[model samples]
Target: MPPRVLHFKSIYLNRSETFIDRLIRHLQRYDPIVATLFPKHYTENLPIYTPSGWWAWRRDCWLKQLNRTPRFLYGLCRRLQPALVHAHFGLDGYRLIGLARKTGLPLVVSFYGHDVSRLPDAAGWQRRYQRLALQGTRFIAATEAMKQQLLRLGFPETRIAVVRFGLDLHQFAFQARHQAGPRLLLVGRLVEKKGHAVALEAVARLHALGIEARLSCLGDGPLRNALKEKAQKLGIADRVLFYGEVTNEQVHDAYYTHDVLLVPSQTATDGDQEGLPNVLIEGLACGIPVIATRHAGIPELVQHESTGLLVPEGDAEALAAAILRLMETPGLVARLSYAGRLAVEQLHSLERMVGDVEAVYDDVLKCIP
Candidate 1:
């Protein structure tokens, strides 16, 4: 019989999708029964959805709702009876760990930045719950740096594995540059951490320097209208195009049509940050040179001066300078584009990520017997 692995996540937002979806889509390759919480548009051959209310709470009700999740998750696991459970974030990890202890199934959890960093700061019980989650499950780190964070959090080194997120190389392969326009693309939520305001400020700087460039903003959030107002105030509204909440296919097309991908992410005031934005890897895979901030897990993917240019977080002037450098320098774009694509092909392919994940599953399963 094939091994069964249950995957758990809360909400299934378009921007929040990642390699987990890719793994679910290709589960037959690993012969595992993949299960997920939260409903999404169906993909053929993947396991059916198991509903969970882990992420439907507003800020005011989150604490009360979170307290009830462990019971709900335990009930879900009792019904599914899987060999192993993989939770996608630390909070979900806590819930799964509780279920694992109740059901005697092996459990694994992935830490994706904000959950580990910001969620732990909530209150005494939440902090204790975070520790409990880390203690009960095998931890999957997206970067070596994240692994170290887990170590410092008192997790046993033996229980942690560093497995960076991967990309579909076939989907994001390098293609010939087709457009003549200087297009700068930013693909992320229009929120404070994503630094859409920084991108707008940088574009304003570029306009002041008399550089003709168009900026395309993708993805949507609560701050979308505010960001648009900021762009108008900066007098670069005409140059900025807001293509909010685009599909994955549209995102791939944007990668090819644009000359450069800008990811000006910053550590938010509440300590939220980017956990290696998949779009950087996707853009690099599509052979588009990226200009991103030297923040969070980004440096692990973008080799400074090789794959793409890195500027200090929240520095619009430096961002503008980097963007101008990529636009003005002939042959530099081609060199960086080729190097970025090669880096993704060699280091960030889905095969490599899945292989690492399977190894972790094997180790966890061995511990079960």
Candidate 2:
């Protein structure tokens, strides 16, 4: 029988966290179950443990009021008998550090984007992370850039492993898009780091250049109103369509309808950055040409006119030019499309991610007597 691994996330499954679900679901060599502080209702199909309704209220009370570990969680860990605990984020790992010590289970923590870049800036987090770093058996980062952040956080160099989110090629099949006009797609939560405002400026610039390019933005966030206002002010609101949040199927289908995938991600004012946008990988897998900014792990994937076109982060003029270049040059688009698909196939397949993840688990388990 395969060894059981407990997957811990503060929130079981947010709509934007499908990648975490993929990791939990695609483990072939290990039995996986979820333990979240609050599990989403849609997660009923999975083997998960969470305090619901009044029980959850009581759990919060225990955590905040009495300042003690919830007996429910303590008991759940004992009952489930998982060989190791894999926490999804640095904050969640900090929350579970005490529990792991009490249960005497090896803990593996994954730092994706904001957790490594943004969380360290918070007051008291550095000290908290130092504790987690010392206690955690292994750490997973999405890129070498993120690994550097972990290194600065005092994580042992030997314990940190760089793992990319694997894209399922069969799910995101390549399709040659032969659209009438330039239909640009930006798929991410409307946020500072996502650079939605920059994308709007680029679209506005395209219009100013006499190119009638339409922009479709998928997903929504706190900046939704601000981004809509910015688009309206730019006078490109007529050409911009904000679909808010949509299902994964809708996003996949949107890729086929659009001409270019725009990933204008940047470092936020609060120091938040991207690990690597899965949309970039998904768009590349779909064989759509992508125009992204040179930020974080983005450059690691987009090799500037090789796999896809890249621009300086927060530079609207440069982004508009990249889009214009793609519009005027069909050969460039086709070349990028072919290379992008090939790159994702070789570097970011789900099979490869699962094998790498399980290999880490195997190494962590080997240390056990």
Model number with the top lDDT = 2
- Per-residue error (Å), model 1, residue 146: 1.9
TM-score for candidate 2: 0.95
**Candidate 1, position 119, lDDT:** 72
Reference-based lDDT, each prediction: 0.76, 0.86
lDDT of 2 by residue, 43-116 (tens): 85689876657877576546733323445667778887888989888887777777778998898999889998
The digit string of per-residue lDDT tens for model 1 on 44-157 reads: 556555435445324213532564343444555666666788877777677555567667887788887786566766766366654664556588888876776667666778
TM-score of 1: 0.90
Which residue pairs show backbone clashes in model 2? none
Model 1 residue pairs with clashes: none
Summed backbone clashes in each candidate are 0, 0
